[model samples]
Target: MSDAAAPGQPVLADLTTIGVGGPAVRLVEPTTGDELLAAARDAFTSDEPWFVLGGGSNLVVADDGFDGTVIRVATRGIEVLSETDDGVRIRVAAGHPWDDLVAETVARGWSGIEALSGIPGSVGASPVQNIGAYGQEVSATVVSADFLDADTLEFVRVPRANMGLAYRTSVFKAGQSHPARPGVITAVEFELHNGGGVSEPVAYAQLASALGVALGDRVPVADVRDRVLALRASKGMVLDPADADTRSCGSFFTNPIVSPEALEGVPADAPRWESSPEAQDVAVPLGELPAPPPPPAPAAVKLSAAWLIEHSGIPRGFSLPGSRAAISSKHTLAITNRGGATAAEVTELARFVQSRVASEFGVLLHPEPILLGAFL
Candidate 1:
């Protein structure tokens, strides 16, 4: 329940993990339910361009700074509503860090979101983008996400089915943020597995193979989390400020799921699966060729966006002359800040990659993070 910045107080850069962006116009941290609700409704009534800023991880703010009020959802809580052999019902505050909730659930031997172990950002934002990692997305287990219906100015806890969780997007993430159209997510509720200590059947082939086990194997929940974290750490997906690769917002683009026709357009050796050059080639060749002479890339395949970027001739760390920002040297999907780069500069580099990928692969790559002030 703190007041907005008084005067000299600096903005998000001091607190955000990204280490960039200009000062926020106004930053409000609402610790109580009434405060959060009042601030949201007030901004709505006044026609203020308000955004519910959370974890600040999966966001890229512009250089000019947000020119409107920013409601920082600092409201926090995590409670076990029920426990049983079938499932566990629990509710989490929107402001809670996503990984913290995952860890807590895993620690208590819960088996729903363990595979989303290393993802960054807030619980509220999870439903917004359907935060995903390894083989698990928050959408798979979310029973409901509670939000203040900005339109009606009332509490509405929409069911998971109504949230519209796609590969890595949702209604909240897909809509515009104007007075006429804004989705202010407040909290989320999940129903996790309490069926003994067994995990959900492993879905990702890479994950199953890494555990030296076959697909559909149900290993210990803890082991799955441990293995997933190790893999993400290697790719700098898990946060590490010292390493520039980690200085990125995880994977920049989602793995493209192309139509059957789109699949046929792609070549046989095209880096198809995510995670590697050879692995993609291997995944396709392992099974019998799909019918229809192999359309673009089937909805059957998850094309590696990083491979597309590299093959597009924009190698990691490749930047135009005299630019501080560039692609990450460790991975191509991540566009990095090589120190002293402004938000606009980052935006420019991002556009360049998208343009190049379009020209090269004929696939338009979309940004995965929340971009403010300008489109990514």
Candidate 2:
């Protein structure tokens, strides 16, 4: 329904929070579920490359631009499927803004996602990345999702168990390749409890400290949401048109999870957390138990990418030669578009950072954003 040169038309730069990338050849904004399905099917059947866009917070497209159709999901709806003494189950449209839904649920005393406040992107994108912050990930609350599998040309209800949700990836993220032939998420369902103004046990240390509570203590949900928003704003994680630091794909790299042997030669004070065991062990049916466990494997460790970058000598606000794109002034983890930046510039900066980190620590940092025609 839209072209790149139409009056007030949107380019990738306008659509993305990073404010970079070239225009799409054609863009379709579908406002209904049926329309979304039809648009996806049309693009798939035509055998042309296509991309699905949500809030456009986690993308970096190439300067040459996409030559295929782009489907912008704009559909919106939320319905409570049922409520019980234990909790409530609700279904949300894929196009819904993630933070808005968090705010709404928090306002109504929902306990599952208060820690996810101020995250950018859409509800549908959450499961793809297993979006998490302050120690709470979408994988914890997701019950199921209604996905249109373009490969099979059928709608399938994928339960959380089948989603392959991990630290920050799922089957959906794996299917990002062949975009026109990938499964299209239509809606997601969540189960949240009525916590009576209280929150789930505080998990992240920074959040606990912000609320003046000890780790593992529960606080008021409203307090948690407010403090989370304030904390995110401080790091420029929340969107603000005037703040150059906020003009980024949030957290450009994921924390690297490595085997115990990979931690050699790193500084003693480097931030690291123990990685959880693989899901298969915990996901087995309740009554079915595996035989006696084999000897324990070396514990996997998750290292902080921000710590690695700073220690590797790349400081905040660092930029490549003659490029407007730079590391966020507020946080070492973000690569920001400091106005008039191009996708190539962003890519250049990212690659430079990765090289520095790898050279200093022997670990290559991988980008967290979805790259379209752009590579590090």
Candidate 3:
């Protein structure tokens, strides 16, 4: 465990993808899982407020910065736990780079995560957000994770069935319920298919169009990754040091999930999808009569935040006059720092966008990024 005090100033602005935020009072970087667990334990036992920092892609720190201890895990390893004829079960250290893991899996013909190519963040943070893209969600492949339970201060293994994973959120996230236990993830296990050099069938329409293939076509695994990266780069979703537009926490707002009736206020042509299909499959025992079906469950609707923002008159590349914070020129879903933008500016712009969408469509937009010492 590297308990050595950080030298000089340690500003979060230098660590995060977005060029904002102030300095941390103390920063600890653990190079191994044991060290990470140790650091987490120490933080938990102390009274100081602390947080685990991952890739810093889905976080926004206030200009005043976090006055608490910050634990940054640097543990690294990818182990093949088990292998069978059709699939491979592997475990990854929480600190492993997520895209690198995807690349490695695709190169080895593992098909489950091919569509999640260019997402930025660490493996540890993946399940917390149930990260997804191009119709491939991490929840679909995650098998289990090892963690240092915050409540008990003990290490435990949690299975996927208890994760409470849903669109863009999990029990590990704040304001969420932990079916198993809330803790700091130390490692994650995934079950990946041996695709024989092909990818999962195309599930997202945009991805299918980019690959010049119809939905359900299984392109080469490498090709899917290449196209996914290209798509992300085009939208400024991929991180790039030279692209100012890429200097942001990818999507500022999560698509608003609303009851079907609540969507009546939205435009008829607005892009919306059913969050979950009503369950219909049923079974009857041999020689036993089938029972009548119960009432169908109501399906929730997910409205596109980008479409709502655009329709509410907030266009891409928009910014408050004389303010450095602005909406990404490539994607309205992101609020960007033009350079030297403050947390106040970012929140101001976020609030403005939210107010506009709410007034126009009667729908409230919630931020996808975790705001530390800031609110929207």
Model 3 residue 292 distance off true place after TM-score fit, in angstroms: 33
Models 1 onward score TM values of 0.86, 0.91, 0.91
**Candidate 3 lDDT by residue in tens digits, 1-376:** 1112256757887778886777788899999987998999999888978888899998888877777888987889999998877999999999999999998998898899999999999999999999999989999999999989888898989899988887787878864322534568999999999868788889999999999999999999999999999999999999988888999999988787777766667889999888763222232221123355345447767788899999999999999999999999999999998898987788889888988888888887777777775331
TM-score of 2: 0.91
Q: Which candidate tops lDDT?
A: 3
Give the C-alpha miss distance for residue 43 in model 3, angstroms. Answer: 0.5
* Candidate order by decreasing lDDT: 3, 2, 1
Select the stronger candidate by lDDT from 2 and 3.
Answer: 3
- Compose the digit string of candidate 1's lDDT tens values, residues 1-376: 1223347654655455555576666778888767888888887776557678888887777665666778888888898999997899999998889889988888888898988988888888888888877678888889988788777787888898877676776777733221122657777899999957678889888799878888888988889889998888877777887886676667766676555445554567886543311112111111123122222232345677888788888877798778777787777877777777666677778778877876776665667666765432
Regions more than 4 Å wrong, model 3: 1-7, 177-181, 277-297, 374-376
Q: Whole-model lDDT for model 1 versus the true structure?
A: 0.73
Superposed model 1: Cα runs more than 4 Å off = 1-9, 175-181, 271-301, 374-376
- Compute the lDDT of residue 184 as modeled in candidate 2: 80
